[model samples]
Target: MDSAFFSMIFRMKYITRWGLMRSSYPETLSEHSMDTAVLAHALACIGASRLDKPVDPMKAAVFALFHDAGEIITGDMPTPIKYHDPQITEAYKRIEAEANRTLFSMLPDDLKPYYEPVFHPAKEDEAYWQYVKAADKLSALIKCIEEEKSGNSEFKDAKAQLLSMLSSFDLPEVQVFMQEFLPAFSKTLDEQSRE
Candidate 1:
């Protein structure tokens, strides 16, 4: 009879990120998810309105919001470990799938349907998923930019690698986001405040 499942998910803030690097500002899974959701929504909107691709921004946002929910169960695996090689990446994907299932099991039977789509969408929503992926990378790029701004040398190579990876996406929405939105992340507080 205990159906307070979401409260567990809400503790995503407890899952800290950048475990390997010294973060000037600590980031949590909750914060990353929120940024990913907002960026996904924005990218979806830009695609629909500007790039001639129609997508449901709200759906994309919701998908992004739950994209990292599996991290709550698996903990935040560092990217290097998660993608160290094809075998490791495939193994981690399986682990993540199980973790996602474990997360869904917490929901009450009646509410399972409501969250299932958010956790695992249908094939038709591939474009939405792609937008979420782009948003995730964009969020990471922003994090790298923030680290560089804090004068941390740790993220220097990460920023360059992220930029290279991002450019490979070749999605117009991703391109537009990089060109029109990403540059501002490099700005100073004074410059942002003035604008």
Candidate 2:
């Protein structure tokens, strides 16, 4: 039997919502995935410690890392297309679900269980999911911070929308992270710009 790890090495093509350097960020799904994974783990750990929630931080991180694995085959559909409208959004979600099912099928039987939870997460892990969603938004917010630092107004609307999404989440730890740390990213962005 072939080892399953080789299946994951296929180079994916993604259309980034963030534009190329001239106007926007040139983010890729792979880079975004890594950031989300780290943020997910940190937020989950912080939430568990602060809120007494029994969340598996590692699992959450893993989940976030692979959450968009389906995009490898389906490609990254921007939020504008994925959520153009209620009907369009629901249809795109169904497409994503179908794509994930297809991706799960490519894995060996032994690896399926290991990946299914990430490909089609359970509702029981809602809190963990929340953290991942928050991480996604935070990642975009960080991107906007960088973009704005580069004197790009393209991400200004994105920054506002991301902050709005961040504020909508009820997690105290996440809120605290936003409150205490997010603003500093701008300074960091500015300092890094000259580097």
Candidate 3:
């Protein structure tokens, strides 16, 4: 049977993020996913090469790519509403799981096993998952930085919150990325080129 899996994946471009706030430059899920994947790869590489951790950069990057695949089906739920209450958060998690299952089922049966670990990560890859989570937060923080740089004060609170959340991770690789790479996001293209 033919699969609609790739077609569904392409629909990621249609899902806009930061639904509750005004954005200086609107972002699509596809863009966010790509950013997250890049960050995840960097963080994992930092962990493995610099920190002597056994993280797989490629695996983390691939996982990060699909971290929010469920959001395509559920639509982008505003963060405030998604976490307003404990029960609501739990309910949303269930809904996201169901959405992932539905998306996974779109794959051809022979390919399902290969993609299963991405949709439902194995326990052994829990450490790598942490990297993906950090990457996800970093992506959001980058968005906030860009908005603020564009003179959009709407994301100020979010920038602070994301920074705090990332700080709490206490991962050396994350700290390194924040220190070494994040500041560049606020620089002008000319300034970056001059450096």
Candidate 4:
């Protein structure tokens, strides 16, 4: 089989994030996925280590890595437009499902099983998927912070809105992460180095 299919997935690197906003720094889907994976891992670890939950950081990390793989085909839709209406959201989900299916088809039959679980997990993984969702929001929040750090006021409202959305989740792990790590994003590099 030709390796052309893999190239399509790698094209995620060219998809810019925050397409609707004036960003101080351009971010790519590939970059965001990696950040989300790391954040998901940390959130999962926090849940397991401190919250007495049996969360698997590695699983969460892997899930987060491909959480937006569908976006490679659909392009990164702005969150506001993506969630503004119930109908639109539902339609977009269907589009994403189709995209995932297309992505899965790219791999050889022998390798499909391994990739499927990453893009589409079993029902039992629903609980853990929450952590991936939370990490996605946290990653956005971090992006807001980064924009603010760049002296760009465009993200000020976004930062507040993201914080509100995250707070509404009220997940113990998210709360813990916000308390212990989120504040650090606001600090200077020197301050972080000292700590």
Best by TM-score: 3
lDDT of 2 at 134: 88
TM-score of each: 0.96, 0.87, 0.98, 0.96
Give the clashing residue pairs of candidate 4, or none: none
lDDT by residue for model 1 (1-195), tens: 885468878989999988988889999999999999999999999988998786889999999999989898888989987788999999888999888888888888888888888766788988889999999999999999999998988988888988999899968888888998788899998998898
Scored by CA lDDT, what does every candidate get?
A: 0.89, 0.77, 0.95, 0.89
Best by lDDT: 3
For model 4, the stretches where C-alpha displacement exceeds 4 angstroms are none
Clash count list over all predictions: 0, 0, 0, 0
Candidate no. 1 TM-score: 0.96
**Which runs of model 1 end up more than 4 angstroms from their true locations?**
none
lDDT of 4 by residue, 6-84 (tens): 7887888999999889998899999999999999999899988998887789999989989999888999989889999
Error of 1 at 68 (Å): 0.8
Local error of candidate 2 at residue 65 (angstroms): 0.2
Which of 1 and 3 is the better model by lDDT? 3
